[model samples]
Target chain A: MKFMSNKTLKMSKVLLSAVLSVGIIASLSGCGSNESAKNSATPPADSAGSNLIVSQTNPIVIDKEAKTVKVYTEVNGKYFVEPTRHGVVFKDGSNGSKSVLKAWGNQNDFYNGLVDIGAKPGNNLKLDSVGVAVEGDPLDVSITWAGAGKEIPFGDGILDSTKKGFDFRFGGNQENAKAKNTGCILCLDSCPVGITSNAAHPTKDFDNKIAEFKGNQEVLPADGTPVVVTFKLK
Target chain B: MNTKQRKWLNVLGSGLLGFNFGFVAALLLAQWTWLELRVNTGLAILVGVGIGLGIGLLRTIKRPLAVESISLLAMLISLLGIGDAQISSLKILTGYTIREGLLMPDISLQVANLIFSLLTLGSILSAIVLKRKISG
Candidate 1:
């Protein structure tokens, strides 16, 4: 009986050790798999001027003749916008640009579904037209930031770009645009050009960091300070 | 130890092993699918029966009471594992920050858990009872 008990104890120890070994191996493999998955899904950052510049002090130029707004990104590099169809729109007069930035789906969906507007190789969003309004003086333009319900204003100032030699300029600091509490830096919506995401929906390659600069606080512009356009109002 | 106590120990060990295997399987499945495929009633039933049968065969316990008790414990543990795996999967698939995922409403998850729990219990009980009768 004593011998039989000893054998059973030995077997039990062997079984426990085997289970532990398998568990450890499984966990390690899981970590490895996750790391690979994350790496593969990360968006490429190799493009020239691959940084976003939020202009705090510069006014986004409105070209009424071209029916487009020249959105000045610090770097002409890649960028993305959400709700591909209606990326940038103007709030007609100061209702706070609220109607212009409606959520595409549930409000929560806005938090991570920012579409890439200009990050692909050879694919650049140099100029987007404002789809909602073609001609108007002092249009209230705004862009939707992820999850935030409020529109980031392009300052209370208004300019008519159609006027010959009417130098159109709007002002605000880049700090407000980059701040989590503040909305977008450039009110790209006032421009007559419409912007769209590269993809119909956000793919794994969509970089959340660009939308919500979580830990990285420094607002690094890819190019130099964004180009400032002087507009001659009609 | 007496034969009766040894049999109980065997049942306990088998149940623990079953739980571990089932948990691992559920976790792996969740990761592979990225939470798109949830642990539902059918999955729960499969995990419970597979674990119960594997334990019964491995332990070769003849006591009906021991078999039933172990099956119950194993099924419960497996359910917990499934729940945990699904939550983790949701966090990953939704792309939510860790804090957001954890705080998000889990009404659907709760409903799934209830269904899976019931299905697992029924399947495990049936497996244990059938095995006992066959052995007898």
Candidate 2:
């Protein structure tokens, strides 16, 4: 009986040690296996339907004293203020006006009006500054674009002289000029400029000539700035 | 061997077996459909109870009190092992901290706790009431 009991005690110790060793090995092995699985399973950053615009440059500058919003883009080795689409809506508490400026081509095409300097279109139409001369401190301001979608919220509407306007670049390096243009439709509702107004307001209407153009809409270009929208509250 | 030493050996063997079973069950639950991994309270409780009942039936203890105690201990040990495995799997698979994974509104930890408690109670009761087979 004594010999049998001694053997039993030895067996118990062996079993306990075996169980502990297996548990330790299992726990440590899990971390390494999990790491490898995670690396292999992650998906690409820009798989279809992922609306990621990769722009590294700041493009919009707001001049409060000058009451002007300036938008700039790199075109043909030069910085130009010409955007494929630009619009500004100005309201003072009660009423407002919405003005839309668009270049010729499908709304989704990014390179519609791009031309050389001293080109036939002239500088007046190519300039990036949209002037809104309104009286009584035009308390509310909303800006929109045709080729870009809403990527960030435009914080409170109040703009100070020191405040710089919002800047965004579309379609990073792969400048597919034919990328679909999903327009920003909530710019006014997201603006923090004026007191919350519930009254129905006028919407900016696109130019019939440009809107009617039945051209092949190409993807945005892969290099340089394709689409940029900047809002400067003055 | 003495009764105390034999009882302790039985407990240790049963507890370790229960832990291993629980860990594998948790891993299987984690690798199930994505939604199951996110909210596997029902599965965890079921696994805990099953392990406890299985371990209890395999032990030689016949007294109701001893059976209940062993089963309860095994259940607690297994549940703890399962919880650890679940947290590790969530971190490895989803890159989410255990807190982040469990804090989602849809995957309530409170619900899991309730299920675990109720199942553990049922398992303890079953162990005490179930008859053990007699071997000549």
Candidate 3:
């Protein structure tokens, strides 16, 4: 390194600083203005006022080329939830699914809980935030959280990504498929019927229709698309 | 460079590499998804890559693969900072950040921008510290 001239070091400093400063400024500056009240500080929590169920969709497709998952979900409230497609979409690059899930808690347990409890990851999942609500019986969602915010049905550990994620699968008639490695604590142990496990097993719980379709392809009755889905909440 | 010096240098260099690509991916997520990211995705990525290339230059000048551990560690650290940076600013901008991804699909719009912005910063900081030895 001594062979390198001092001029070279100085140039490196200037260049590194220039690039670093610019990158930092771009990201921090582009947030528009936090001071503006226009910021939707609070995400719409309940869908009662809309007289419809709010739906949030996660569309996940396996990208065999990348040996990784390329996932996209509807950020704004949406509808027509599809079960086969949802689950954490694993993006190959930044906004990587791993850390992002930490903001919520643990994607595995949370996602698994949702699926096992009838919440599908693909475009078939719905919450009361906005969009179309399921017209059937009301959804019984057990919720939890790691930080402060509006309480979500079956929402907990929404901000934690350090732990192992939970597994989402269907219950084949042969045996209940247990998607292991749950990241969230078991919030609910008892239900009206004995169909639920003290450990919040989605496969054992009969309440979750999404969990019933694990490992097997099922045809969707609503869209006639031969897809699987869960009941969306409004 | 000596074995010890080379090892540390690589640590700093590797982070820049991971951070560069990570920054780019983060920006796209912000743009495509309505989720507001903290930093400008485009600029952040450029910065990350520039710093990474700079680190790479330093490595090749002295040694190659000497900083392998550092690179992997830095990459992981870079990912961690992304969330940190976003949450810090988000708490200030909105009363809350992402507790649940209710707004957008996977992440909340509120915290999305903030998280990636912080990630860019983390990479920049890593680059600066790592390059200091080489530059000086």
**How would you encode candidate 3's per-residue C-alpha lDDT over B52-134 as one tens digit per residue?**
66655465424222232233334334433443445333232221122122123343333454664465455555555555555
lDDT of 3 by residue, A132-209 (tens): 111221333222111223333222312112222233222111111123222211212111111111222222222333
lDDT of 2 at B77: 55
Single out the weakest 10-residue window by summed lDDT for candidate 3 chain A. Answer: A217-226
- Please give the range of 10 consecutive residues that has the lowest summed lDDT in model 3 chain B: B93-102
Q: If the candidates were sorted by their lDDT against the true structure, best first, what order would they fall in? A: 3, 1, 2
For every prediction, compared with the true complex, DockQ reads: 0.04, 0.02, 0.10
Q: Write the per-residue lDDT of candidate 2 for residues B1-136, one digit (tens) a residue.
A: 5656555544543443343345335544543333331253224423543564466457754443343444334433543454454533222222111112233322222232233333334433333333222111
Model 1 — TM-score against the truth? 0.24
Model 1, residue A137: displacement in angstroms? 18
Q: What is candidate 1's CA lDDT for residue B47?
A: 58
> What order do candidates take by DockQ, descending?
3, 1, 2
Q: A8-52, model 2: which lDDT tens digit per residue?
A: 445544543443444345434444442332233211122123243
Model 1 chain B: ten consecutive residues of lowest lDDT = B91-100
**Each candidate's lDDT (Cα)?**
0.29, 0.28, 0.31
Better of 1 and 3 by DockQ: 3
